[model samples]
Target chain A: MSGVKKPVERRLRGEAVPALDVARIRADFPILDQQVYGKPLVYLDNAATTQKPRAVIDAVTRYYEHDNSNVHRGVHALSQRATEEYEGVREKVRAFLNARSVRELVFVRGATEAINLVAATFGRMRVREGGEILLTEMEHHSNIVPWQLLAEQTGAVLKVVPITDSGELVMEEFERLLGPRTRLVAVAHLSNALGTINPVRRIIGLAHAQGVPVLLDGAQAAPHIRVDVQDLDCDFYAFSGHKLYGPTGIGVLYGKEKWLEDMPPYQGGGEMIRQVSFKRSTYSDIPAKFEAGTPNIAGAIGLGAAIDYVQAIGLDAIAAHEHSVLEYALAAAEEVPGMRVVGCARAKASILSFVLERIHPHDIGTILDRQGLAVRVGHHCAMPVMEHYCLPATARASFAVYNTREEVDVLMAGIRKVREVFGQ
Target chain B: MNDLRDLYQEVIFDHNRNPRNCYCMKGANRTAEGFNPLCGDRLTLYLKVEDGKIAEASFQGSGCAISTASASLMTEALKGKSLEEAERLFQAFHGRITRDTGGAAPVDLGKLEVLSGVSEFPTRVKCATLAWHTLNAALEDKGEPVTSE
Candidate 1:
C-alpha cells in the first residue's frame, strides 16, 4: 500500500521538483548562467523582476527585425503585420486570463499604470464624495496611492481591512469594512512583501453581494498562479509582464465588457479616438479606447511569446516545483540562528520574506550579494505591510520556475556568511 | 570576499554593536533628521553649540552597520570641534568615501577613515554619508528633515 502511493506521498512531502525539469528550464534563461564576485550567481529576486527567457528575447528581436512599423492607420505590409502581431497578443492575454472576450484586456505600461488607469477612469466615475474605497493592509504602494489620489480628488474616504499577525487578511475586518458606502474594493491578489495568497475569491464574493465592484492587484499573483477573471468575477484585474518573464513597460488590465463600455477613455490620442472635430470628439472601442497612442508593440508581442512558453511547460508544474523549493528553503532556514520568516500564511506562494534579529536587511543584502546571491532587502514597495509587522525592512528571497533547491542551499550558506560577518 | 571585508571592517562592527551617544538630547539648540527611505535608515542628530565650537553631540535612530557606525563615530569626533573644523571634516569625509583616491594622498579623517572602504561599494556610500549630511543640516538649521533620496 505504501509503495502504491509513493508518488503521491512524495508530492505531499514537498519532494516534487521532478514535476518539471528545472535544470532544463534554467538553461532557457541565459542570464541565470553567469558569475558575480567570482561566485556562481544564485538569483533569488524573482519577486522584484524575473529574467527573460530566450523565447521572449527572440520574439522581441524578431518584431524589430521583420515587422517594425507603426501599428494601425498604415497601409503598408509591415504595418499590417505589426498590427496583427500586437492584436494577437491581446487575444493571447485574454485566453490566458480565461476572460469572456478579447475586449476585456487593455494593455498599459505595467500593473502600476493599469491601476492608475482604473483610478482615473472607473474610480472617478463610480466613487463619489463621502463614499469609501476599501482596501487591505497588505497592499503594495501601487495599489494604495492611486486610490488615495482618487480620494483626495473626489472627497472619498479610504477604509482599510486589517490583517492577522500571520499576514492573513482578517475576514471579519473585511466584512465589517464592506458596507453600503463602499464604492470599490482594491486589494492585492498576493502580498509581495509577505507572500500571502489572499482569499480574493471570497473577497470578490463578499463585495459582489454588496453590489460593490472589486479590482484585484495581481502584480504578484499573475506570474505564480492561474488567474481566471470570469471565475473570480473581479470587475478588473491588473498584472505586469516583466514579473511574468516578459518584457518591461507592458501590462494588462482585464475589465468586464459592460464596465469597459461604460468607463471613459483613459487617455486621448490618435488610436483611441474614432473621429475628432473642433467641437466634439468620439473615442474608439473597449481596448483601443484605453490604449491612447502607439503602444509598446514589441513588449506585447514578447508577452505573447511568454504566454506560449509558460503554457507549454504548464503553470501547475511550475507551481509544484516552486512549492518544493520554498519548503526546502523554509526548512533550511531553521538552522540559521536568529532567523525569522515574516509571512506565515497557510496558503502562500514562493516568496520567503524574513529578517535577522538585530541585523539590518540592507547589511544582509550587501553580504549575500557579495556571495553572488541576489535578494531584495527593503520594504519592497509595501511599506504598509512593513508597518503592520512593525518592521522597517525585510530581506526577501523569492523563487521562480527556474529556481532550484540547490540555489536555496547556496542562499542558506550565504546567510550563514552574513551572520559570521556580523560576528553574531 | 576581500572587498566585503574591507567595507564591513571590525571598527564598523564595533561601532554598530555599541553606538556611542545614541540618545535624544534634552537641551539641544540645533537638530536635524536624516532619512533614507529606500533602506529605511532614519536618525535624528542633535548638536549643542557654544561659542562657535560643538559642546555636545548625540543621535538616536536605527540603520545598518555602515550608517549606524558612521553616526556613532561622527558624534564622537564632533565633540569640542570648532564649527569651521566640522565643516572641513564633513567635506573630507564625503570626498574620501566618493572619490577614487587615484594614488593621491588620502584625506585625514582620523577614526572616520575606517569608512573610506565605502568607495569600493558604491551603493553603501550614501549609507556612510547620511549622518554627515544631517550634520550639515543641523549646522545650517535647515528646519526640515534631510533625505538621501
Candidate 2:
C-alpha cells in the first residue's frame, strides 16, 4: 500500500518542481519552466493571479488567428464567428454560476471594474439619501472604496459589519446592522488575505428578508470552491478570470435579469446603443448595455476554456485536494515555534496567512524568496481587515489545484529559518 | 537546503537584530511619518537642524529588515552632515537603488552599498528607500511642509 501511494504522496506535496511526470496536467502550462536567481521557481502566490494553461492560451490564440473581428454588428463570417464564441462564453458562465439567464452575465475588465459598475449604476439609481450600504470588515479595498466613492457622490450612509478575532464574520452583528434603511449589502465570498470562507448564503438570505440586494465578491471564492449563484440566492456575483487560470483583462458579473433591467446603463458607447441618431438615442439590451466598448473577445473565450479545464478536473476532487493541502499546511505551520497563523477559522479555503512572533511579514517574505518560495506579504488591499485583527500585515500562502502537501513542508522549513534569523 | 547566508548576509541579519541609533530625538525641529502601505511599514523620522547642519537625527517605528536597517544606517549617516550634503547623499542613494545610469555613477553610499542587492528584487526597492524618503522630508530647513514618499 505504501509503495502504491508514493506517487500520490508526491502529487499531494505540491511539488511541481519540473522533475515530476504529471504530464497531462503539466503540459497544459508552458510558462512553468526557466530560472529565477539561478534556482527553479516555486510560485505560491496563486491568489494574486493564476498561471494560464495551454488550453486557455490556445483558445486566445485560436480566436485571434481564425476569428478576429468586432462583435454584435458584423455580418461577415469572422464577425459571426466572434459573436457566437463571445456569447457562447456568457452561457458557459451562466451555467458555471447557475445563473437564471445569459442576459444576467456581463463581461468587464475584471472583478474591480465589475464592482465599480454596480456601485456606480445600481447605487446611483436605487440608493437614496440616508440609505445604508452595509459591508463587512474583511472586504477588499475594491469592495470598500467603490461604496465610499458612491456614498460621497450620493447622500447614502455607509455601515460596516464587524468580524470576530478568529477572522470569521460576526453574523449577529451583521443582522443587527441590517434594518429598513439598508439599501444594499456587499461582502466578499472569501477573504483574499485570510482564507476565511464567509457564510454568504445565510447573510444573503437575511438581507433579502429585509428587501435589500446583495453582491458577492467571488474573486477569491470562484477559483477555489464550487459556486452556485442560484443556491446562494445572491442578487449579484462578480469574479475575475485571471484568478481562475484564464487570461487577464476579462471577468464576469452575474446579476438577476430583473435587477439588471431596472438599473441604467453604466457607460454609453458603441454596440450599447439601439439606435444612434444623436437625438434621443435608445439603449441596447442588458448585458451589452453594461459592456459599452469593444469587449475582450479572446479573453472571454479563454475563460470558457478555463471553465472547461476546471470541469474536466472535477471541482469536487479539486476541493478535496486543496482541503488536504490546507490541513497539511496548518499542521506544518503549527510545528514552527513563534509562528502564529493569522486566520484560524474552521471554515476556510486553502489560504494560510501568518506572522512570526517578532519578525515582520516583509522580512519573512524576503527570506522565503531567497529559498525560491513565493508568498504574498502585505496588507493584501484589505486595510480594515488588518485593523480588525490589530495587525499591520500578514504573510499569505494561498493554494490552488496544482499545489501539493510537500510544498507546505517546504514553507514550514522556510519559516523556521526566519525564526532562527530573528532570534525568536 | 541552500545557503541562507547568501540572502540574509551576516551584515543584514546583524543590523536587523540590533539596529543602531534606533530612538526618537527630543524637541526636533522637523518630523515626518513615512509609510509603505503595501507592506504596512511605518516610520517616524525626527530631525534637528542648526546652522544648516543636522544637529540630531533619530527614528522610531516598525518595519521589515531592509527598512529598519536602512533607517538605522540613515540615522547614523545624517547625524552631523550639512543639509546640502544630506541631500546629495539622498540623490546618490536613490540613483544607486534605481540603477538608471548603468550603476557607473559614484554615489559613495559606503556600507549602504550592501543594499545594492535590493535592486535585484523589484518589489523591495520601496522598502529600502522608505527611510531615506522620510529623512529628506524632515531635513527641509525652510519650514517646508513634511511629506511622505
Candidate 3:
C-alpha cells in the first residue's frame, strides 16, 4: 500500500506544471528564437519532426569536417577513422534499443523504408499466400501502406484491430484476430496522430504465444518513452532519427538476430555483399545485408550524438516533464468554449489534437500562426483515423522537452481567438 | 497578432459559418469525393449538367472554413454557366488561388477574388482549392478538361 501511494503521488504531481528550465532548453535549439510573421515562433509540431539541438548540429558538422572518407573499405587513416565512427553508431544504437547485439541493428533511410525492408525481406520469406497480418486502425500511413503492399504482393490477408472511441486499441478484438494463420503482427508503439501509447508489450507477448512474429513501429515512441527491445521481446522495431531530435534522412531497424539471419537481403549493392561474381553474388551478414549503398554517414553520427543528448537529460525526466505539459495543455484547452480535444486516450504522449466548433483546422492553424504559434493542421497522414472520428482534420499541438507551460497558455489563447473569429 | 485582422477578414468567417450551396443534388448527373488527408478535409461534389451547361452545382462535406466556404463560392460561381465558361472560370479561380498566371486577365473573379489572398498562405491554398479539385473531377464527363492549380 505504501508503494502504491508513492506511484499515485508521483502521478498526481506529474500533472502539475513542470518546473522546466525553458530558457536553458530553448538555448539548445537556436531555431526557436526566430520570428515568424513578426512574432516569436512557438513551435508545437514535435510529432511531425523535432527541431535539432546544437549538439546534434555540431556532431554532423564535425563528422563532415574531420572524418570525411569512405567507410569499411578504405585503407587510409581518414577512412579507418570514418569507418570506426560509422560502425560506432551501430553500437550506440544497439545500446539505445537494449538490443542483444550490434548485428541486430540495421540503418535505413527512415521508418517508411525500414518497414518496407521488413515487408519485402521478412514478409516475403516467412509469410505464405494464406497467412494473416494483424494491424490496428490507428496506424500512420507509413505503418499501414507497407504491409498493404506486402499483402498485395504475397496474397496475405490484412486484418485490422479495431479501436475504441477513446482511440485505445480493442485488445479483446485483437486477441480474436490472432490465430494459427497469423504470421506477423505489425503495430505502432504509439499513435502519432492520437498520442495513444499502445500496449505493445502485451501485444508482442500475445503474438509470440501464437508463434507469430511482431514488428513494432517505434517512430513516435522512441523520443518520448523508455523502450527496451529485450524487455518487449519484439521481433523487429523501427524508428526515425528526425523524430528523435536527430538529423533527417536517417533511421534504424532493430530485428532479432535469428530473424535477421533467416531473412534474405533487401537491397543489392557494393557493401551488402560478402563476395561478388558475374554469375553469383553472396550477401553479407545481418545488418550489412540490409544497408547496401553509401549510408548517411553524417546523419548516423548525428543520431548517435542525439542519443547521447537524450541519455544526458534522462528519458524518465523527459517523460515526466512532457507528461506535465500535456496535462496542463489538456486542462487549459478544455476551458476554451467550442474547443473539443480529440484523441482522449488514457495512456497518451504529449500531443493535443483538437478542433474548434464551426471553425476548420486550417483556419485554426492560420490564426495560431499569426500569433506566432506553430501547430500542425490536417489529417496527419492518418486518414482512416480522421474518417473514424468523422472529422475533416484536426489542429495538433505536440510538445517536446523544450516546450514550456507558457507556450501552452499561448496555444490556449490561440484557441480562444479561433472561437472568437468563428463566432462560436 | 499584428495582422490578426488580415488573417480572419469578416468575409472569410461569414462564408465559413453559413456556407451557401452546401448540399447534395438529389438527382445530379455526377458526383466525386475529394479528400485532403493531411488536413482531414473531405468533400463530395455534385453537378447537374443539362445540354453542355452546368444547370446546378453543390458541394457536401466537412472541412475547415477555407475549404467549406471555398466550395460554397465555387458552386455559386459555376451555376448557370456554359460548360466552356465554367471551365474557364475554374482555371481563373485556380490561378487566383495559387498565384499562377494565364487566367482570364485581371478582373474575372469578382467576389471570389478575395481568395487571391489565400496564395499568401501556401498551406491553406490546398485547403481553399480542394473543393475546386472535386468540382473538376465531377465535371470531367462534360467532355471538357478543367485544369486546377
- Most lDDT-accurate candidate: 1
lDDT (Cα, tens digit) per residue for candidate 2, span A1-424:
2443354456556643222233456567777664556655667898999888889999999999999999988899999999999999999998888898899999998999999999999999989889999999999999999999999898899999988888898899999999999999999999998889999989999999989999999999998888998899999899999999999999999999999998999998997889988568889988898989899999999999999998888665676677667877877777788889888776888799998887889888887887778899899999988888778899999888777767787788888877776666
Worst 10 residues of 2 chain A by lDDT: A15-24
Sort candidate 2 into its docking category: medium
For candidate 3, the iRMS in Å is 1.8
Comparing candidate 1 with candidate 2, which one achieves the higher DockQ? 1
Q: How well does candidate 3 score on lDDT at residue B24? A: 76
TM-score of chain A of each: 0.97, 0.93, 0.96
Comparing candidate 2 with candidate 3, which one achieves the higher TM-score? Answer: 3
As for candidate 1, its clashing pairs are: none
Clashing pairs in 2: A12-A405, A13-A404, A13-A405, A13-A406, A14-A403, A14-A404, A28-A54
- The lowest-lDDT stretch of 10 consecutive residues in candidate 3 chain A is A1-10
TM-score, candidate 3, is 0.93
**Model 2 per-residue lDDT tens digits across residues B1-149:** 23444335667767777888778878888788888777788888888889999888888888888888888888888889999999988888887777764445566788887777777767778888888888877765334433223
Superposed on the true interface residues, model 2 gives a C-alpha RMSD in angstroms of: 2.1
Q: So what's the TM-score on candidate 2?
A: 0.92
Best by DockQ: 1
lDDT of 3 by residue, A1-424 (tens): 2432354347747655345576897899989989988878999999999999999999999988898988889999999998899899999998888999999999998888899999999999988898899999999999999888988998999999989989999999999999999999999998988999999989988999989999999999999998899999999999999999999999999999999999999989988999999999999987899999899989999999999888878777788778778887877876787889889998999789998777778888888888889999888888888878988788899999899978998889878877776666
The parts of candidate 3 lying over 4 Å away from their true place are: A1-9, A12-20, B1-4, B30-33, B142-149
